[model samples]
Target: MDIPYTSKPRPDTGLYNAKVGIWLFLASEVMLFGALFSSYILLRVGALEENWPHGLLNIPIGTFNTAVLIISSVTVVMAWASLKMKQFGRFKIFQAITVLCALAFLGIKSFEYKDKFTHYEVWKTDGTRMTGHIEGNPMFLTKAKLVAAGKDKIEFLADPHHYSEGKLKIGAQSGEHKHVEIAIGDIKRLSAFVPAHSTYFAIYFTLTALHALHVLGGAIVIGFLFGPGSKMWHTDPDRFTNRVEVAGLFWHFVDLVWIFLFPVLYLL
Candidate 1:
Protein backbone atom coordinates (compact mmCIF):
# COMPACT_ATOMS: atom_id res chain seq x y z
CA MET A 1 0.00 0.00 0.00
CA ASP A 2 1.24 3.53 -0.72
CA ILE A 3 1.97 5.65 2.34
CA PRO A 4 0.03 8.86 2.38
CA TYR A 5 1.37 12.36 3.04
CA THR A 6 5.01 11.59 2.25
CA SER A 7 4.98 14.91 0.41
CA LYS A 8 1.33 15.93 0.49
CA PRO A 9 0.00 17.47 3.72
CA ARG A 10 -2.80 15.78 5.59
CA PRO A 11 -6.04 17.75 5.52
CA ASP A 12 -6.56 17.92 9.29
CA THR A 13 -2.92 18.58 10.32
CA GLY A 14 -1.74 20.60 7.34
CA LEU A 15 1.61 18.79 7.52
CA TYR A 16 3.15 15.92 5.56
CA ASN A 17 3.98 12.68 7.41
CA ALA A 18 7.71 13.43 7.25
CA LYS A 19 7.24 16.94 8.66
CA VAL A 20 5.13 15.62 11.54
CA GLY A 21 7.71 12.99 12.29
CA ILE A 22 10.43 15.58 12.36
CA TRP A 23 8.49 17.79 14.78
CA LEU A 24 7.84 14.91 17.13
CA PHE A 25 11.53 14.00 17.05
CA LEU A 26 12.41 17.61 17.71
CA ALA A 27 10.09 17.75 20.71
CA SER A 28 11.97 14.88 22.31
CA GLU A 29 15.24 16.57 21.55
CA VAL A 30 14.00 19.71 23.32
CA MET A 31 13.31 17.71 26.46
CA LEU A 32 16.72 16.05 26.30
CA PHE A 33 18.59 19.33 26.14
CA GLY A 34 16.29 20.97 28.65
CA ALA A 35 17.27 18.38 31.21
CA LEU A 36 20.94 19.02 30.56
CA PHE A 37 20.47 22.76 30.95
CA SER A 38 18.62 22.28 34.21
CA SER A 39 21.36 20.06 35.50
CA TYR A 40 23.98 22.64 34.65
CA ILE A 41 22.09 25.35 36.47
CA LEU A 42 21.64 23.24 39.55
CA LEU A 43 25.30 22.32 39.55
CA ARG A 44 26.43 25.89 39.17
CA VAL A 45 24.15 27.23 41.90
CA GLY A 46 24.97 24.56 44.43
CA ALA A 47 28.73 24.80 44.09
CA LEU A 48 30.74 27.06 46.36
CA GLU A 49 31.59 30.41 44.77
CA GLU A 50 35.30 30.29 45.45
CA ASN A 51 35.64 26.61 44.55
CA TRP A 52 34.12 27.00 41.10
CA PRO A 53 36.54 27.73 38.31
CA HIS A 54 35.97 30.58 35.89
CA GLY A 55 37.73 32.14 32.91
CA LEU A 56 39.61 28.90 32.38
CA LEU A 57 38.01 28.16 29.03
CA ASN A 58 39.19 30.10 26.00
CA ILE A 59 36.58 32.69 25.11
CA PRO A 60 37.97 33.67 21.71
CA ILE A 61 37.79 30.09 20.47
CA GLY A 62 34.27 29.68 21.81
CA THR A 63 33.25 32.87 20.03
CA PHE A 64 34.63 31.55 16.75
CA ASN A 65 32.66 28.30 17.05
CA THR A 66 29.52 30.29 17.79
CA ALA A 67 30.01 32.31 14.60
CA VAL A 68 30.53 29.16 12.56
CA LEU A 69 27.32 27.61 13.83
CA ILE A 70 25.30 30.79 13.36
CA ILE A 71 26.47 31.03 9.73
CA SER A 72 25.68 27.37 9.10
CA SER A 73 22.17 27.88 10.44
CA VAL A 74 21.64 30.62 7.87
CA THR A 75 23.06 28.59 5.00
CA VAL A 76 20.93 25.55 5.84
CA VAL A 77 17.82 27.69 5.63
CA MET A 78 18.92 29.12 2.32
CA ALA A 79 19.52 25.63 1.00
CA TRP A 80 15.99 24.57 1.83
CA ALA A 81 14.65 27.82 0.42
CA SER A 82 16.57 27.18 -2.79
CA LEU A 83 14.69 23.90 -3.20
CA LYS A 84 11.38 25.72 -2.74
CA MET A 85 12.42 28.08 -5.54
CA LYS A 86 13.44 25.08 -7.71
CA GLN A 87 17.06 26.25 -7.77
CA PHE A 88 18.90 22.95 -7.55
CA GLY A 89 22.41 24.31 -8.11
CA ARG A 90 21.93 26.97 -5.45
CA PHE A 91 20.66 24.35 -3.03
CA LYS A 92 23.80 22.25 -3.57
CA ILE A 93 26.08 25.22 -3.02
CA PHE A 94 24.41 26.30 0.20
CA GLN A 95 24.23 22.75 1.53
CA ALA A 96 27.95 22.29 0.91
CA ILE A 97 28.69 25.49 2.78
CA THR A 98 26.60 24.23 5.70
CA VAL A 99 28.61 21.03 5.82
CA LEU A 100 31.92 22.92 5.68
CA CYS A 101 30.86 25.04 8.65
CA ALA A 102 30.13 21.92 10.64
CA LEU A 103 33.64 20.63 9.93
CA ALA A 104 35.17 23.90 11.01
CA PHE A 105 33.22 23.98 14.26
CA LEU A 106 34.26 20.44 15.11
CA GLY A 107 37.90 21.24 14.32
CA ILE A 108 37.88 24.21 16.68
CA LYS A 109 36.19 22.18 19.41
CA SER A 110 38.87 19.52 19.14
CA PHE A 111 41.56 22.13 19.63
CA GLU A 112 39.82 23.42 22.74
CA TYR A 113 39.60 19.93 24.17
CA LYS A 114 43.31 19.41 23.52
CA ASP A 115 44.16 22.50 25.50
CA LYS A 116 42.13 21.34 28.49
CA PHE A 117 43.79 17.96 28.48
CA THR A 118 47.24 19.52 28.47
CA HIS A 119 46.55 22.12 31.19
CA TYR A 120 47.46 21.07 34.73
CA GLU A 121 46.20 21.89 38.20
CA VAL A 122 48.23 21.33 41.36
CA TRP A 123 47.06 21.39 44.96
CA LYS A 124 49.63 22.24 47.63
CA THR A 125 49.77 20.90 51.19
CA ASP A 126 48.70 24.33 52.44
CA GLY A 127 45.38 24.02 50.49
CA THR A 128 46.42 26.43 47.75
CA ARG A 129 45.41 25.22 44.26
CA MET A 130 47.54 26.27 41.30
CA THR A 131 46.50 25.74 37.70
CA GLY A 132 48.49 26.24 34.51
CA HIS A 133 50.22 24.57 31.56
CA ILE A 134 52.84 22.16 32.86
CA GLU A 135 56.54 22.63 32.22
CA GLY A 136 57.26 18.89 32.56
CA ASN A 137 55.98 15.73 34.19
CA PRO A 138 55.36 16.60 37.84
CA MET A 139 58.24 14.99 39.70
CA PHE A 140 57.21 12.56 42.45
CA LEU A 141 59.41 13.34 45.42
CA THR A 142 59.43 9.99 47.22
CA LYS A 143 59.55 9.92 51.02
CA ALA A 144 63.30 9.38 50.78
CA LYS A 145 63.72 12.34 48.42
CA LEU A 146 61.50 14.57 50.56
CA VAL A 147 63.62 13.79 53.63
CA ALA A 148 66.94 14.01 51.74
CA ALA A 149 66.31 17.66 50.95
CA GLY A 150 63.51 20.12 51.58
CA LYS A 151 63.06 20.28 47.72
CA ASP A 152 59.49 19.01 47.34
CA LYS A 153 57.83 21.13 44.72
CA ILE A 154 56.28 20.66 41.26
CA GLU A 155 57.25 23.26 38.66
CA PHE A 156 54.48 24.99 36.62
CA LEU A 157 53.50 28.42 35.41
CA ALA A 158 50.88 29.89 37.69
CA ASP A 159 47.52 30.21 35.90
CA PRO A 160 47.31 33.79 34.68
CA HIS A 161 44.34 34.67 36.82
CA HIS A 162 45.67 33.08 40.05
CA TYR A 163 47.80 36.09 40.77
CA SER A 164 45.79 39.25 40.07
CA GLU A 165 48.79 41.48 40.81
CA GLY A 166 50.37 43.97 38.42
CA LYS A 167 52.51 41.21 36.87
CA LEU A 168 49.65 39.27 35.22
CA LYS A 169 47.82 42.44 34.14
CA ILE A 170 50.47 43.46 31.60
CA GLY A 171 52.01 40.57 29.68
CA ALA A 172 52.12 38.89 26.21
CA GLN A 173 50.64 35.68 27.85
CA SER A 174 51.76 33.20 25.21
CA GLY A 175 54.71 30.81 25.84
CA GLU A 176 55.86 33.20 28.54
CA HIS A 177 53.82 33.22 31.76
CA LYS A 178 55.01 33.42 35.38
CA HIS A 179 56.88 30.23 36.28
CA VAL A 180 57.20 28.87 39.84
CA GLU A 181 58.95 25.95 41.49
CA ILE A 182 56.79 24.11 44.02
CA ALA A 183 58.36 21.54 46.35
CA ILE A 184 57.05 18.02 45.78
CA GLY A 185 56.42 17.54 49.53
CA ASP A 186 54.34 20.69 49.49
CA ILE A 187 52.31 19.41 46.53
CA LYS A 188 49.29 17.42 47.58
CA ARG A 189 48.17 16.32 44.10
CA LEU A 190 48.45 17.44 40.51
CA SER A 191 46.71 16.47 37.29
CA ALA A 192 45.54 17.89 33.99
CA PHE A 193 42.19 19.68 33.89
CA VAL A 194 40.48 16.65 32.38
CA PRO A 195 36.97 15.33 32.84
CA ALA A 196 38.08 13.46 35.96
CA HIS A 197 39.73 16.56 37.37
CA SER A 198 36.62 18.21 38.78
CA THR A 199 32.85 18.36 38.61
CA TYR A 200 32.96 21.40 36.35
CA PHE A 201 35.17 19.63 33.86
CA ALA A 202 33.14 16.43 34.02
CA ILE A 203 29.95 18.26 33.14
CA TYR A 204 31.71 20.42 30.58
CA PHE A 205 32.99 17.37 28.72
CA THR A 206 29.66 15.59 28.87
CA LEU A 207 27.56 18.43 27.53
CA THR A 208 29.95 19.54 24.78
CA ALA A 209 30.70 16.01 23.60
CA LEU A 210 26.98 15.24 23.29
CA HIS A 211 26.48 18.43 21.28
CA ALA A 212 29.42 17.57 19.03
CA LEU A 213 27.85 14.20 18.27
CA HIS A 214 24.65 15.98 17.30
CA VAL A 215 26.62 18.25 14.94
CA LEU A 216 28.27 15.22 13.34
CA GLY A 217 24.94 13.49 12.90
CA GLY A 218 23.39 16.59 11.37
CA ALA A 219 26.33 16.99 9.01
CA ILE A 220 25.99 13.41 7.72
CA VAL A 221 22.29 13.88 7.07
CA ILE A 222 22.92 17.20 5.31
CA GLY A 223 25.74 15.75 3.24
CA PHE A 224 23.57 12.82 2.18
CA LEU A 225 20.70 15.13 1.26
CA PHE A 226 23.13 17.18 -0.80
CA GLY A 227 24.48 14.18 -2.73
CA PRO A 228 22.79 10.77 -2.97
CA GLY A 229 19.52 12.02 -1.56
CA SER A 230 19.34 14.64 -4.31
CA LYS A 231 18.41 11.85 -6.74
CA MET A 232 14.96 11.96 -5.20
CA TRP A 233 14.72 15.53 -6.44
CA HIS A 234 14.37 14.25 -9.98
CA THR A 235 12.17 11.20 -9.42
CA ASP A 236 10.04 12.65 -6.62
CA PRO A 237 10.55 16.36 -6.27
CA ASP A 238 7.89 16.98 -3.61
CA ARG A 239 9.17 14.20 -1.38
CA PHE A 240 12.74 15.47 -1.72
CA THR A 241 11.70 18.99 -0.78
CA ASN A 242 9.92 17.71 2.31
CA ARG A 243 13.08 15.83 3.30
CA VAL A 244 15.11 18.99 2.95
CA GLU A 245 12.69 20.90 5.18
CA VAL A 246 12.82 18.21 7.83
CA ALA A 247 16.62 18.12 7.81
CA GLY A 248 16.80 21.89 7.99
CA LEU A 249 14.57 21.92 11.03
CA PHE A 250 16.90 19.49 12.81
CA TRP A 251 19.92 21.58 11.86
CA HIS A 252 18.35 24.69 13.36
CA PHE A 253 17.70 22.88 16.61
CA VAL A 254 21.32 21.77 16.71
CA ASP A 255 22.46 25.34 16.24
CA LEU A 256 20.13 26.60 18.94
CA VAL A 257 21.57 24.12 21.43
CA TRP A 258 25.07 25.47 20.79
CA ILE A 259 23.86 29.03 21.28
CA PHE A 260 22.83 28.08 24.82
CA LEU A 261 25.93 25.97 25.36
CA PHE A 262 28.48 28.64 24.45
CA PRO A 263 27.27 31.07 27.08
CA VAL A 264 26.70 28.63 29.94
CA LEU A 265 30.03 26.87 29.43
CA TYR A 266 32.30 29.50 27.95
CA LEU A 267 31.11 32.99 28.80
CA LEU A 268 29.39 32.62 32.15
Candidate 2:
Protein backbone atom coordinates (compact mmCIF):
# COMPACT_ATOMS: atom_id res chain seq x y z
CA MET A 1 0.00 0.00 0.00
CA ASP A 2 1.12 3.57 -0.64
CA ILE A 3 2.24 5.57 2.39
CA PRO A 4 -0.08 8.24 3.82
CA TYR A 5 1.02 11.84 4.58
CA THR A 6 3.77 11.63 1.94
CA SER A 7 2.64 15.00 0.65
CA LYS A 8 -0.39 15.95 2.72
CA PRO A 9 -0.69 17.12 6.29
CA ARG A 10 -2.00 14.80 9.00
CA PRO A 11 -5.28 15.73 10.74
CA ASP A 12 -3.95 15.49 14.32
CA THR A 13 -0.70 17.36 13.72
CA GLY A 14 -1.71 19.57 10.81
CA LEU A 15 1.83 18.96 9.43
CA TYR A 16 3.13 16.49 6.89
CA ASN A 17 4.82 13.34 8.16
CA ALA A 18 8.17 14.33 6.63
CA LYS A 19 7.96 17.81 8.17
CA VAL A 20 7.47 16.39 11.66
CA GLY A 21 10.20 13.86 11.07
CA ILE A 22 12.72 16.50 9.92
CA TRP A 23 12.02 18.63 12.98
CA LEU A 24 12.64 15.69 15.30
CA PHE A 25 15.84 14.80 13.45
CA LEU A 26 17.11 18.38 13.68
CA ALA A 27 16.36 18.45 17.42
CA SER A 28 18.61 15.43 17.90
CA GLU A 29 21.30 17.06 15.78
CA VAL A 30 21.17 20.13 18.02
CA MET A 31 21.79 18.04 21.13
CA LEU A 32 24.73 16.22 19.50
CA PHE A 33 26.45 19.41 18.45
CA GLY A 34 25.54 21.09 21.72
CA ALA A 35 27.39 18.46 23.76
CA LEU A 36 30.49 18.78 21.61
CA PHE A 37 30.39 22.58 21.80
CA SER A 38 30.12 22.40 25.57
CA SER A 39 33.15 20.11 25.63
CA TYR A 40 35.11 22.62 23.54
CA ILE A 41 34.34 25.40 25.98
CA LEU A 42 35.36 23.33 28.99
CA LEU A 43 38.58 22.26 27.30
CA ARG A 44 39.50 25.76 26.20
CA VAL A 45 38.74 27.32 29.55
CA GLY A 46 40.53 24.66 31.56
CA ALA A 47 43.68 24.58 29.41
CA LEU A 48 46.93 25.85 30.93
CA GLU A 49 47.40 29.45 29.81
CA GLU A 50 51.00 29.24 28.65
CA ASN A 51 50.55 25.91 26.85
CA TRP A 52 47.41 26.81 24.95
CA PRO A 53 48.11 27.09 21.21
CA HIS A 54 47.23 30.35 19.48
CA GLY A 55 47.60 31.78 15.99
CA LEU A 56 48.12 28.29 14.56
CA LEU A 57 45.07 28.02 12.29
CA ASN A 58 44.90 30.16 9.15
CA ILE A 59 42.20 32.73 9.90
CA PRO A 60 42.00 34.05 6.37
CA ILE A 61 41.27 30.59 4.99
CA GLY A 62 38.65 30.01 7.63
CA THR A 63 36.99 33.37 6.98
CA PHE A 64 36.76 32.48 3.31
CA ASN A 65 35.09 29.17 4.08
CA THR A 66 32.63 30.97 6.32
CA ALA A 67 31.72 33.26 3.49
CA VAL A 68 31.27 30.28 1.18
CA LEU A 69 28.75 28.66 3.51
CA ILE A 70 26.87 31.91 4.01
CA ILE A 71 26.54 32.40 0.28
CA SER A 72 25.39 28.81 -0.22
CA SER A 73 22.66 29.44 2.31
CA VAL A 74 21.45 32.30 0.20
CA THR A 75 21.47 30.11 -2.86
CA VAL A 76 19.44 27.51 -1.07
CA VAL A 77 16.73 30.06 -0.45
CA MET A 78 16.86 31.22 -4.03
CA ALA A 79 16.51 27.66 -5.27
CA TRP A 80 13.47 27.03 -3.12
CA ALA A 81 11.93 30.31 -4.20
CA SER A 82 12.44 29.42 -7.84
CA LEU A 83 10.63 26.12 -7.44
CA LYS A 84 7.72 27.86 -5.68
CA MET A 85 7.55 30.22 -8.66
CA LYS A 86 7.45 27.21 -11.02
CA GLN A 87 10.67 28.40 -12.65
CA PHE A 88 12.45 25.06 -13.08
CA GLY A 89 15.43 26.53 -14.98
CA ARG A 90 16.16 29.04 -12.24
CA PHE A 91 15.86 26.36 -9.58
CA LYS A 92 18.39 24.25 -11.44
CA ILE A 93 20.90 27.11 -11.62
CA PHE A 94 20.59 27.96 -7.94
CA GLN A 95 20.87 24.32 -6.81
CA ALA A 96 23.93 23.83 -9.01
CA ILE A 97 25.62 26.77 -7.31
CA THR A 98 24.81 25.26 -3.92
CA VAL A 99 26.61 22.03 -4.88
CA LEU A 100 29.64 23.95 -6.19
CA CYS A 101 29.85 25.87 -2.94
CA ALA A 102 29.85 22.63 -0.96
CA LEU A 103 32.73 21.29 -3.05
CA ALA A 104 34.71 24.50 -2.55
CA PHE A 105 34.26 24.30 1.22
CA LEU A 106 35.52 20.70 1.31
CA GLY A 107 38.53 21.54 -0.86
CA ILE A 108 39.62 24.30 1.50
CA LYS A 109 39.14 22.07 4.54
CA SER A 110 41.49 19.46 2.97
CA PHE A 111 44.19 22.09 2.48
CA GLU A 112 44.00 23.09 6.14
CA TYR A 113 44.28 19.44 7.21
CA LYS A 114 47.34 18.97 5.00
CA ASP A 115 49.07 21.98 6.59
CA LYS A 116 48.51 20.63 10.11
CA PHE A 117 49.91 17.19 9.19
CA THR A 118 53.13 18.70 7.84
CA HIS A 119 53.78 20.92 10.87
CA TYR A 120 55.92 19.48 13.65
CA GLU A 121 57.02 20.10 17.25
CA VAL A 122 60.03 18.56 18.97
CA TRP A 123 61.02 18.40 22.61
CA LYS A 124 64.50 17.56 23.86
CA THR A 125 65.68 16.18 27.20
CA ASP A 126 67.74 19.33 27.77
CA GLY A 127 64.46 21.28 28.14
CA THR A 128 64.72 22.72 24.63
CA ARG A 129 61.86 22.71 22.10
CA MET A 130 61.57 23.35 18.35
CA THR A 131 58.67 23.97 15.99
CA GLY A 132 58.72 23.75 12.18
CA HIS A 133 57.49 21.79 9.20
CA ILE A 134 59.45 18.63 8.38
CA GLU A 135 61.33 19.26 5.13
CA GLY A 136 61.68 15.60 4.09
CA ASN A 137 60.90 12.11 5.27
CA PRO A 138 62.38 11.59 8.76
CA MET A 139 65.16 9.09 8.13
CA PHE A 140 65.63 5.99 10.26
CA LEU A 141 68.89 6.21 12.24
CA THR A 142 71.12 3.22 11.55
CA LYS A 143 74.07 2.70 13.94
CA ALA A 144 76.45 3.41 11.05
CA LYS A 145 74.70 6.70 10.19
CA LEU A 146 74.85 7.76 13.86
CA VAL A 147 78.58 6.93 14.03
CA ALA A 148 79.28 8.89 10.81
CA ALA A 149 77.52 11.96 12.29
CA GLY A 150 79.94 11.82 15.22
CA LYS A 151 77.13 13.08 17.43
CA ASP A 152 74.49 11.53 19.66
CA LYS A 153 71.60 13.27 17.89
CA ILE A 154 69.37 12.25 15.01
CA GLU A 155 69.86 14.82 12.20
CA PHE A 156 67.07 16.35 10.18
CA LEU A 157 66.37 19.74 8.59
CA ALA A 158 63.45 21.89 9.68
CA ASP A 159 61.41 23.70 7.07
CA PRO A 160 63.46 26.85 6.48
CA HIS A 161 60.52 29.17 7.03
CA HIS A 162 60.22 28.33 10.78
CA TYR A 163 63.96 27.68 11.31
CA SER A 164 65.84 30.06 13.55
CA GLU A 165 69.55 30.71 14.00
CA GLY A 166 71.53 30.36 17.24
CA LYS A 167 68.62 30.47 19.68
CA LEU A 168 67.33 27.37 21.47
CA LYS A 169 64.16 26.64 23.51
CA ILE A 170 60.56 26.84 22.32
CA GLY A 171 59.65 29.99 20.37
CA ALA A 172 57.78 31.24 17.34
CA GLN A 173 59.16 30.62 13.82
CA SER A 174 61.91 33.06 12.88
CA GLY A 175 65.55 33.65 11.75
CA GLU A 176 68.03 31.63 9.64
CA HIS A 177 67.52 28.11 8.24
CA LYS A 178 69.62 25.12 9.43
CA HIS A 179 69.73 21.39 10.12
CA VAL A 180 68.88 20.37 13.72
CA GLU A 181 69.44 17.25 15.76
CA ILE A 182 67.82 15.66 18.78
CA ALA A 183 69.63 12.83 20.51
CA ILE A 184 67.40 9.75 20.88
CA GLY A 185 68.37 9.52 24.51
CA ASP A 186 67.86 13.26 24.83
CA ILE A 187 64.58 13.21 22.96
CA LYS A 188 61.62 13.87 25.20
CA ARG A 189 58.95 13.82 22.48
CA LEU A 190 58.56 14.39 18.72
CA SER A 191 55.31 14.60 16.83
CA ALA A 192 53.37 16.54 14.23
CA PHE A 193 50.37 18.76 15.12
CA VAL A 194 48.20 15.68 15.13
CA PRO A 195 45.35 14.69 17.48
CA ALA A 196 47.71 12.77 19.81
CA HIS A 197 50.07 15.72 20.20
CA SER A 198 47.87 17.69 22.59
CA THR A 199 44.38 18.10 23.99
CA TYR A 200 43.84 21.08 21.71
CA PHE A 201 44.61 19.11 18.57
CA ALA A 202 42.64 16.09 19.72
CA ILE A 203 39.42 18.12 20.07
CA TYR A 204 40.23 20.18 17.00
CA PHE A 205 40.40 17.17 14.67
CA THR A 206 37.47 15.36 16.25
CA LEU A 207 35.00 18.25 16.15
CA THR A 208 35.95 19.64 12.76
CA ALA A 209 36.01 16.20 11.15
CA LEU A 210 32.54 15.47 12.50
CA HIS A 211 31.22 18.75 11.10
CA ALA A 212 32.84 18.07 7.75
CA LEU A 213 31.06 14.74 7.58
CA HIS A 214 27.78 16.57 8.11
CA VAL A 215 28.63 18.89 5.26
CA LEU A 216 29.40 15.90 3.06
CA GLY A 217 26.10 14.27 3.99
CA GLY A 218 24.13 17.43 3.27
CA ALA A 219 25.84 17.79 -0.08
CA ILE A 220 24.98 14.26 -1.10
CA VAL A 221 21.30 14.78 -0.32
CA ILE A 222 21.21 18.15 -2.06
CA GLY A 223 23.00 16.58 -5.03
CA PHE A 224 20.43 13.82 -5.35
CA LEU A 225 17.57 16.30 -5.09
CA PHE A 226 19.20 18.43 -7.75
CA GLY A 227 19.72 15.56 -10.19
CA PRO A 228 17.70 12.31 -10.23
CA GLY A 229 15.24 13.52 -7.65
CA SER A 230 14.22 16.41 -9.89
CA LYS A 231 12.26 13.88 -11.92
CA MET A 232 9.56 14.09 -9.28
CA TRP A 233 8.83 17.68 -10.34
CA HIS A 234 7.50 16.46 -13.66
CA THR A 235 5.17 13.91 -12.08
CA ASP A 236 4.27 15.67 -8.84
CA PRO A 237 5.33 19.29 -8.63
CA ASP A 238 4.00 19.97 -5.14
CA ARG A 239 5.65 16.93 -3.61
CA PHE A 240 8.90 17.75 -5.35
CA THR A 241 8.81 21.31 -4.06
CA ASN A 242 8.21 19.99 -0.54
CA ARG A 243 11.26 17.78 -0.94
CA VAL A 244 13.37 20.80 -1.88
CA GLU A 245 12.03 22.71 1.11
CA VAL A 246 12.95 19.87 3.45
CA ALA A 247 16.44 19.59 1.98
CA GLY A 248 16.89 23.35 2.17
CA LEU A 249 16.02 23.31 5.87
CA PHE A 250 18.79 20.81 6.48
CA TRP A 251 21.22 22.84 4.40
CA HIS A 252 20.49 25.97 6.41
CA PHE A 253 21.17 24.09 9.63
CA VAL A 254 24.51 22.93 8.28
CA ASP A 255 25.43 26.49 7.41
CA LEU A 256 24.37 27.78 10.83
CA VAL A 257 26.59 25.19 12.55
CA TRP A 258 29.59 26.45 10.62
CA ILE A 259 28.76 30.03 11.49
CA PHE A 260 29.06 29.12 15.18
CA LEU A 261 32.09 26.89 14.56
CA PHE A 262 34.12 29.46 12.58
CA PRO A 263 34.22 32.00 15.36
CA VAL A 264 34.40 29.55 18.27
CA LEU A 265 37.23 27.39 16.87
CA TYR A 266 39.01 29.84 14.60
CA LEU A 267 38.80 32.95 16.75
CA LEU A 268 37.86 32.59 20.43
List TM-score per model, in order. Answer: 0.87, 0.85
Steric collisions counted per model: 7, 0
Model 1 worst lDDT run, 10 consecutive residues: 163-172
Query: How does model 2 fare in lDDT?
Result: 0.80
| lDDT (Cα atoms) of all candidates against the true structure | 0.82, 0.80
Return the clash pairs for model 2, or none: none
Candidate 1 TM-score versus the reference: 0.87
Give residue 75's lDDT in candidate 2 (0 to 100): 96
Off by over 4 Å in 1: 136-154, 163-176
Write the residue-wise lDDT of candidate 2 on 152-253 in tens digits.
665656544322232122234445656876565776676777887778888889889988998899899899999999999999898898888899999898
Candidate 1, residues 145-223, lDDT tens digits: the string is 4456765454577755542232323233544467898767677776677777777888899899999999999999999
Lowest lDDT sum, 10 consecutive residues, model 2, at: 162-171
lDDT of 1 at 171: 34
